[model samples]
Target: MRPLLLLPLLITTASAADAVITYDEHIKPIFREHCLKCHGEDEQKADLNLANFTAVLKGGSGDKAVVAGRASTSLLFKAITAEDDAERMPPKKAAIPAPQIELIRQWIQGGLRESSASKSLVAARDTSFKAATALNFDGPPPMPESLPAFTPPQLKRPLPVIAMAASPRAPLIAVAGHEHVRLLDATTQQEIGALPFPEGQPNVIRFSRDGRVLMVAGGKPVQSGSVVLFEVKSGKRLTSVGDETDAVISADLSPDQKLIALGGSGKIVKVYGTDDGKLRHKLTKHTDWITALAFSPDGKSLASADRAGGIHLWDGTSGGILLTLAEHKAAVRALAWRSDSHMLASGGEDGLLIWWDTTDGWPAITNTNAHPPVRPAGYYGKLPNGVLALAFGPQGELLSAGRDKQVRLWAADGRALKSFASETALPLQTSITFDGKGLFAGDAAGAVRFWTTAN
Candidate 1:
């Protein structure tokens, strides 16, 4: 008799416990932290992609990630459920919990509905500024064409920033976030000026050595990519570089202002003439996405680093590969050359600070972990994490920021001088820039933070 009265209550509780696991609410976050990096952006390994709804439906190499309503037979499910460590879904991870696996099982056995996250993914994929084009050596593409006619509100939503730079000569710091660039006063962090980059989110922003012209590189994914030169003081568009089909991930303005070099998804670094925007060198050697590029302080040498930890030095005037420097174990995200251009400082996925003797056949001068390898996410302290930004202080000290959300300074010889954590950031301060007096970092909260020497 008592059970009769409580039966309906128990039934309601059980139904509530089986709440739906929609892509946005339950699944995306799990995939976001664990799977997307390799199968999503930057590169699609094994041709498999979990970045979007369509990609999941159009599975890679092994084919059919999910056959709707058949989770047990799906390759995606099998990979996750495989008992053999080598066959596991993450391939390398300790194994996903049974609860998450069961949740995913329910999702597939149910139907892969176009949830809110799926719709958003589809929208982002379709919002390419320009349809992707093949790599062409013809003079860079033109702006406006390189940019979409209408900016997508989603891309303009101030995604986590990837680039921040301080003018070595001016009291200005340039922060590239979402679809615009903000120039802030180095001392006060006040907005000095802003540039509307409807072309796409800027991937990198650099002020000319004198701090008068700001060189910006970025573009839509799988779409037109280009660089713009803006008169920092007047906020006028000065010059633009073209002929790219993807966002420009890295760029540098030569010290002498004679040449500018940049590289990104194309796997080729293109060096251009600053005066006429002419293609000067089509430096090709990188087999993966180019992640870092720089013209030496003297502007006599150009250094390019890629996701595979490859480093190449090229003749400044000729665009000829001079040497392939000692590389990293994983992607090298940050590169800083000594003021004299005698040494190069690099930090990457290994969480190590490496000094390269650029003049001595680019030999490794010092290799030490900038931060201890974080476990579970990082193996043996190995990547999927590392220093994402580096800058040389006015006194030649190296400044670096990384996934650990820490800022550390190192002596010219690679001695760890100081380290500290700011209370404001969520984590992963990805970009660091030095303005002679202060260190500026870009955080995941869509903020550019300035830390003084005293801090």
Candidate 2:
């Protein structure tokens, strides 16, 4: 009898034992004994019903209980295996058996199957973002034809414009406002249209590679969060991705528009599928909240920076860690990739603007004190010199704003071309127009100011 028990335990831990797990055959009995009382047919907790296979797959309360192939991110698995007594399932009850937890994990990772003959429901995806060999602009760039009518919220005061983006191929700019986004004609500096952001304030605005789609990422702080997409030509709401516990501070879409990566209060950088909204990869290497994220225009690499000033460049295709850039000593505020994707730029709160050559992960140019503090005599302590935002121009020039309340333009060789000073507001965001003739900067005072190379 002792040998028989030991034999089964050994098989469970052996690498050769890759047994198929199904909900009907293996999971039903375990849930009936431990989870049915609270989450089964009789009573549903948090609106989650785990009584049947379909119900478990459907999820509840606007969240999925079982994410097909990700056991670690599945709500059902997290609940049953939670370390906290309060969050753990079967409230106040003894922990579920280790074997049972293992079974559940196998069920999810092997794909949530209904029975022995049912098909595996694992979300198999190609994570790579293949860039186009060359950008082909056949005609004029896409613009909104007819947008849905939306009543703009009457604001008592202008909300701080924290996020903004310029189209890669058009004279348009999207500026984030309070629960809304304003589209401006870069040439005229006039409002062309507006789009509603029912989700909280838009923390990050991005245009797709072709400038045909708009991606806005944000949500109510300390509450719900998600990424919203819209068709640029029609102002049609496309889809929303991610359901985070807090606001997403930074996010970007791949060059092919196949993947969306976002981060916020959580240290993890979650990449999701644009079509199915499934969690594809969780880059958990960051030690602090992710403050900046961007993918290379060539769609070969991804860069994620954190509040701790840690910057990591990853393989854009497989999400593999490529390089850990250790330079900034404070929060990273912005990340920009050149059109050719050979160079990457990062601005941080430490007042350093570094240009990195992605080929070998070396700093090609480091601008220490990129934003020199303008302090009068007797100014004490640390005068603010943090680089707030960065943008790349078409000709490989760079635009940067900083705590110095000045927006400066830099040449491809890191030479200071010109500086535009904003006397009233501190610039927080900056973007360059497609043709490299115009630039836009959003400030702390909720103003989206426009300028050109001639300035």
Candidate 3:
């Protein structure tokens, strides 16, 4: 009897020694010491606060930074577990200790739970879950369900891409680099087409409204700014528009596909007739470089944003200035007009996505640190920065690509929704087009990925 009792006592001691760490003991201290400075109770970095249990679960800018029951799907674990020094957590200078990382992993695998201290923290605070609200960004009209999952193909090139755009109709994706534009099949990682222009480093590529033409912009050394329109199917150059000077920074087409608007260094917007490639109008009102331009869904008005962060609206038919929208502190980079025509979304270098009410001339909604605010906006919340690409689901959930080579989902109102990584590889640029099915994304590495709404 005595020997049996001693054996049971020894087993209990060993079990206690191997017990998994809880939220209070192992996780909170690590977060407080390393992560809370940027993501804490007072300030939420990327809209994430890690000061307490509820906040950690609540997540930040995008949702599901961590999945409670699954460590593999948790972004926090992935970031901490990153192999590359540049991809590691704490961003530039900070590093997570090895023991702490192991502790987190063990806790997650054993079913993450709150400790006595964490329970106290929860008891001291309100721990109710708040349903996130919808954010107003433009894409396909919001749907009740998300699209199905589709993976993007990976490309061989490792060069960082600056801009990406999907073909209007086909599965072709145009990836803009320093001197070449790679045409990739949206469904397969295969390179079906390639356009090389050493004389011009294309900064942006946009398809014609009809999806019949591909327009390329930017210039090479000693070459003036130019715009080349090509037939998508044959890859044949349809028309080339340029002058002795003037580099085109951004371009867009009217809804009718008859008019083309180009903005760049000349402080002027040149409108051309697409049929004959003839110049029709030159509207000049901006004092700085035009960083972004878009035509309303109705094609009645043309919107232009400049480096000075001023938005100028023009009458599409007449070369007349309608109104100047101003509020951003830096150059505006991304612009989208909602289908409703009542709202216009503009993102700038300041990392804010502002939804402007065209009717009231005021912001209907605002999300700070919205994205990196670069040109040729990738998927939803994803910026063109080296970090990740963001997109919005049909249900208005935010989807983002992680530097750890993963894709994360978030609620439209900036709550983390879910997270998933490519089983194959990371994509260069991830984008979602509104095709009535679901959101589709294209990566730089030549992969087309899809995510369907869950029932």
Candidate 4:
């Protein structure tokens, strides 16, 4: 009888220790899911802001939520445990489960220990059951004890992740920050390694059609534009070319891996020999800064889009513009060629998704806008803002990330299938790609979020 009584106390102590909560690891996530949608940085319903600890402690129109050591009288506890539907928090579900509520109660009663950063990334994601634990393989990769020497710290004015690329042959995605590219395992959304290009923040990170090599292009403004080639698996830089005098924003390695083409603020598109870094051809037709580029899967055609709402389809062998696409009313920012090598997709600041038919004789733009529903636009307008990134799925489906922070799936005929709206407020998703089984989005906040492809 004595041992049995002590066993209950021991179990209670251990569970209490495990349940000790923190701001980022526990409370922040809870508030994010249930409260922040209504009282976050954007809206602040009832003048309550719970997005951060300071705001939560300061409370809202009601009063302070926590009183240091009392959980029974805390307004937060009362609202969440209220029996009346109108007075209940979250106002949707019956309420947070008793286990989580008990954890919150224990957390307030025991002095709100803010757990260290070592556990924040995985805290709220703990699995519930043994079987579920086995399936919970989603998270950031194990971070090193310290960042690599070449990797720059996330600066005060963080560099915008302007470019991201996904390999067609594997589950790897590359995201560009200031002066380096982070290669992530698309399935797990973990940082696998860093590919270093220290001259400047990379404007573009593109893998070859075979996915064996990655080409990076960018440099300090007006000084020199550099392009570097690195072996994908080993991170061994193979070649470097520093000749251009402006930022190189658009670049790609041809399917044959024999040539690399890039264009930038210099306004001249140039192709270089992959083996010797020698200039192969220079095509100067556009009058504005180049923004996006892609090579057809068959390696026959190269498409380059510019800031003037113009897309030039060039013959890879002759460097001549094959057909000029002028459907966008603003700058074209993203371009993707279907896997079949027959159709092209382009998106721009005008909130239009135009498909181009690429046949033997006639190549003209299709008249369709694969815009997702207007709900994500909030009170702004009928359509989401511009499309900043685009990708094609394995079976010719389309995926695009918009300025409205919605990622939408589309059929090949320009029909919207489903849309995933990001939960974070004011997330300007700058880049997006598909990795066969999942979709990866990189936003201006330097975070890459991955989600399972919704069928």
User: Scored by CA lDDT, what does every candidate get?
Assistant: 0.68, 0.84, 0.60, 0.68
- Give lDDT: candidate 4, residue 364: 27
Better of 1 and 3 by lDDT: 1
**Stretch of 10 with least lDDT, candidate 2:** 1-10
True-structure lDDT of candidate 4 = 0.68
Residue 73, model 4, lDDT = 56
Q: lDDT by residue for model 4 over 1-455, one digit each (tens)? A: 00111011011221124445777787777778778888899988778898877787788888887654445457887788787988898877678777678667666655555665322221221111111111122333222223344554567766556778787666778888778888777667777778777778788788775566788988888877878988775677888864887778788878788778888887778988877888888878887888888888778999898898888889887788788775566788788877777778888877766666665312222322333334543466555567778887766777777776776666665545666655453233333343356766667766666666433
Number of the candidate with higher TM-score, 3 or 4: 4
Clash count, predicted structure 3 = 37
Residue-wise C-alpha lDDT for candidate 3, range 1-455, written one tens digit per residue = 00111011011111123575788888898888888888886788789888887777777777767764345457888888777989888888656877888677656544566784332111111212233333343454211122122233344564455456665445556777546666665555455556654546675677655556677877753447777776665666677765627557777777777787887877788888878888999888888888777787668888888887788888887868887776565677667665445556676655445556675455434443333222454556644332234433234444445334555444433344444454446543445444422344445554455554442
lDDT score, residue 360, model 1? 53
Q: Would you list the rank order by TM-score, best first? A: 2, 1, 4, 3
lDDT of 2 by residue, 1-455 (tens): 00011011111211113588899999999999998888888898788888899999988895999977556568888888778999888798999998999888778867798998988786443222233366896668988779888777998888888999999888889999888899988888888889999898999999998999999999999998899999988999998999998999999999999999999979999999999999999999999999999999878899999999999999887999999887677899999997778788999888878877777665556665678886889978879779999999888889999998988887776667777776569999999998988878898888877776762
Superposing every Cα of model 1 onto the true structure, what RMSD results? 20.4
Clashing pairs in 4: 141-190
Q: Model 4: residues >4 Å from true position, as ranges?
A: 1-158, 360-384, 425-435
For candidate 1, the 10 contiguous residues with the lowest summed lDDT are: 1-10
Q: What is the TM-score of each predicted model, taking all chains together?
A: 0.63, 0.70, 0.54, 0.62
For candidate 1, write residues 408-454 as lDDT tens digits: 66666555666656345633333333334566667777766666555
lDDT of 4 at 331: 88
TM-score of 1: 0.63
Clashing pairs in 1: 140-242, 140-243, 141-242, 141-243, 373-381
